[model samples]
Target: MERAQPLPSYLVHRYQGWKATGYADNQSWYRRLAELGQHPRAMVISCCDSRVHVTSIFGADQGEFFIHRNIANLVPPFAPDGDYHGTSAAIEYAVTALKVAHLIVLGHSSCGGVKGFHERCLGRAPELAEKTSFVGRWIDLLKPGYERLGGNDADIDSATLEKEAVKVSLENLLTFPFVQEAVDQDKLTLHGVWNDIGEGGLEYYDAKSKAFRPV
Candidate 1:
């Protein structure tokens, strides 16, 4: 087996700097968190995009939110076939074990995953349409969102599809019996949001109006 390489010099230096500053300043708080374990109020499912800074967006401190990031912030409908499911595993843990009060699906503008899905649907990205491509299969979960846009790639808008993908994820979340039960009993709430990366603006889905509103 190949040995794992050490972190890059730049990352190592940054880690040292953080340990001396951020960690030093909040050593006690860190210790308390270690002792108490996490008791986060919400679980955020967001994109793996580097620019989408989850903690910075909410001014969240360590251990405040149980966050899961994937290619397009998608959640597949419940399928318990004993197969490997990373995202579903995270959701199950958050809902059943952590008992998070809220589950939020956060989408962002200019998401590469969303763009790739759009291109794939339009047959512009043949690589993503291949069955063996992991990313292709992952983004295929967004097919429902694509279909919602009339399934006519020629007339589609990527921006609107991004928000629709968020809504689709929220819908898929309820497919889990645990999540459905929690929502039905008022034990957990689900939220969908889209962030405009360029403008630093956030809009949340309003179920009542069936639209996204500025937050």
Candidate 2:
């Protein structure tokens, strides 16, 4: 392993503040979580954007939500192709091992990854096509999502595709047998959420209405 570095000065200061405040106030709760282990009821898959705060949005306590963040908040089609699937592993552990009651796919506006995927797929960004581009390959997962939504138009607005990313992930999450089985047994529920960062508004996908309504 590479040599490990100490925490940055700012991070250390923040840690000390939290230890004196949040952690100190929740010592028993923290000890309980440590002793009993985490039994979060929901697993949230959200974009790795610094602006999207899942816990704060839901007013969730520290151990209440198990969160997995990735580029564009994507969940690939269940392809047990024996590749290094970090997202898949997290989902598997959350659903089968943790037995989470809910799986939430959260999307957001102004996502850099989504923008990258949109521009890259539509041929607007040629630099992302280079072989060494990691973002290009990661964003490539959004291709199947766009195709499912029948959005091949290079001129289509990226914001629309960003919402479709949540839809595609919700669809793809069912491809996992464990998730499907859990839902079939009514042991688990699936949710899709979109966050409008600029407006401070949240829209929830209503399967019956087939639309996102403000929550």
Candidate 3:
């Protein structure tokens, strides 16, 4: 194990500013949250991209959304074979332990991971084709979506594939028996969302319409 280095000067200054402002203003709120423990109503699985701010998007307060971020905002089909699975572990905790009522799979436009996967499947980006590549392997979970959408050549463009990544994650969430049971019991609801980072617009999946509509 290695001791992490001290924070950079800029980050230290930013932390100080937050402590002096946001933290100071909400000191009691923070203390109460620490005492109560987080019981967020929804669990949001979002991309690791910097531009997608879940709190800012929904104007959420602390303890309002339990957020788990990963590459491409993906959720692989449940596999409980004793393998190390960070995303699945988080999902299990959020559903079974936290009992979150809503689970959201949020994808975004201009996602580098999705673009890389799309390019890789098209016989480009040879680096991503390697099994040892972490990004490649993680985004591979979204392949079922591409296959269902017609395999990278189905007249659909790259952006639609990004949205389909959201759809894939939603479908995969159901593969977990706990998640499925919760949904069946009406204790949990699943949602798929695609955000246009540049446009600052959100599109939500509609099961009945089988399409994404802007909100």
RMSD of 2: 1.6
> Which should have the higher TM-score, number 2 or number 3?
3
Question: How much lDDT does candidate 2 score?
Answer: 0.89
Model 1 lDDT tens row, 1-215: 47889899999999999999999999999999999999999999999999999999999989989999999999999999999999999999999999999999999999999899988877899999998999999999998878877886348776789999999999999999999999999999999999999999999999999999999
Candidate lDDT scores, in order, read 0.94, 0.89, 0.94
Q: Which residue runs does candidate 3 get wrong by more than 4 Å? A: 1-3
Residue 60 in candidate 3 has what lDDT? 97
Q: Which regions in candidate 2 have their CA more than 4 angstroms from the true location?
A: 1-3, 148-155
Span of 10 residues, lowest total lDDT, candidate 2 = 150-159
Model 1, residue 16: displacement in angstroms? Answer: 0.7
Per residue, candidate 3 scores C-alpha lDDT tens digits across 1-215 of: 49888889999999999999999999999999999999999999999999999999999999999999999999999999999999999999999999999999999999999999998998899999998999999999988888888886676687899999999899989999999999999999999999998999999999999999998
Residue 123 C-alpha lDDT in model 1: 80
Kindly list the per-residue Cα lDDT of model 2 for residues 1-215, writing each as its tens digit.
Answer: 47988989999999999999999998999999999999999999999999999999999997899899999999988999988998999999999999999999999999999898777767799999888997788778787767766665545666678888888899989999989999999999999999999999999899998788899
Question: If scored against the real structure, what TM-score would every candidate get?
Answer: 0.97, 0.93, 0.97
